[model samples]
Target: MSKQRPNLYYTELDLFILLSKIGLRRKLKPSERRVLVKVYYSEYATPVVPVLITNGKIRLCGDYKLTLNNNLIVDEHSLSTSEELFNGLAEGDKFTKIDLRNAYLNWKVRDEDQHLLTFNTHKGHYNSTRLMFDLNGPPAKWQRKIENILKGIPGVYYL
Candidate 1:
């Protein structure tokens, strides 16, 4: 990472390579149509402690002071509320909970919007072909998709 600017970092080269290997991002080649956009980093407090895996050794993550203004709404889809979720449970209800790991990443970003989601690193500019975390629209989009799929199923209610 760069010392001058917390957001500006050289680690993007390695991060981008890892992401590409995991099919989350791709390197923009000369022949492909490029959508050049600037990416900003933001810091937020999370319940989970941050850790970094460097050279196969785990260590406490460094603190950075870069804030990006997402200007996005939370829970824009008006999905289930806490009360609704609780009410769905009965005293003797036998229910199964499914946690879709990396649910957001599973959704592909539209081709047109890929350019706007491009990020620049020391190596090169890359685009997120799939949805990334902290985006306001992803939750709602995912909720809608799930609702549509679960609709008209036998005794399947999305609470």
Candidate 2:
């Protein structure tokens, strides 16, 4: 009988691709070239967390509650309620659902704020150029960004 192996390694190429998609770039300032965050991995769920190699150990990065409490600003805006969602649809109206894969990664973190999300590894130090998953403020930030974009569009209303 042959045994199947579960993949354990999250290669550097994977990190590179994610960073590329997130538009990550190197900070040229020597003073800024310090590890601001540490990467870690988790297998507590079905899909294993992304792993990064650092000093021969796996590390994961994310602290939602802490990030939210310290870094993000709360807004007055609220998500649509069930009633409001249903009210938006009328008879004969077509409903469409759009799923944006890696939606959080699509949004970029401001250069000034990027340092807040910096992380370090055996390889080097880097900062996030885009919003990362499990960050504290991404949901609110995403809502704000979408709302802003919708404001500029014609015939689009957000409640």
Candidate 3:
């Protein structure tokens, strides 16, 4: 019997093509996270949380559960249930699905709060200017904000 493994590496062209595929869908600000190539002595950087590309979509994620998620406070805002969304829909209403690529990172972190998100890596120390995934607070915060935004609109709904 013979065993074979699929190639799990990506070339630069692959990355360029991947980015091109979803670039328009995610025409986000280039200033998502500042590339801090060096660390200051006074800055307290968290343990290294490497950039994770989950799939072909080039969906980047952060794994701060071990390093940062613990000390942070979780927002207690209630998230909407499937039942609630269905109940709110009327006969004449239509559903519009929007896909946000860099989901949590759409929200920028505050200047003061950005310091807490600093991470140390072999390459260099870095900090996030925008919200990163695996952070405890964004989902609830975003849900609350979405609810508030849709609340004022006449026919818009969020899922």
Top candidate when judged by lDDT against the true structure: 3
TM-scores for every predicted model: 0.50, 0.48, 0.63
lDDT of 2 by residue, 20-133 (tens): 443334433443233233235422111112345666543345333333234345545577787865665544355555664347676756766565554433344346566656
Whole-model lDDT per candidate: 0.46, 0.48, 0.55
Error of 2 at 115 (Å): 1.9
Candidate 1 residue spans exceeding 4 A from truth:
1-75, 152-159
**Model 3 per-residue lDDT at 55:** 60
Model 3 CA lDDT for position 116:
61
Q: 5-72, model 1: which lDDT tens digit per residue? A: 22322343555455444433454454333323323532222111124356663222212222111333
Q: List the residue pairs that clash in candidate 1.
A: none
Clashing pairs in 2: 37-118, 37-119, 37-120, 39-59, 39-60, 40-59, 40-60, 41-59, 41-60
Segments of candidate 2 deviating more than 4 angstroms: 1-60, 64-71, 122-124, 151-159
CA-RMSD of model 3: 11.4
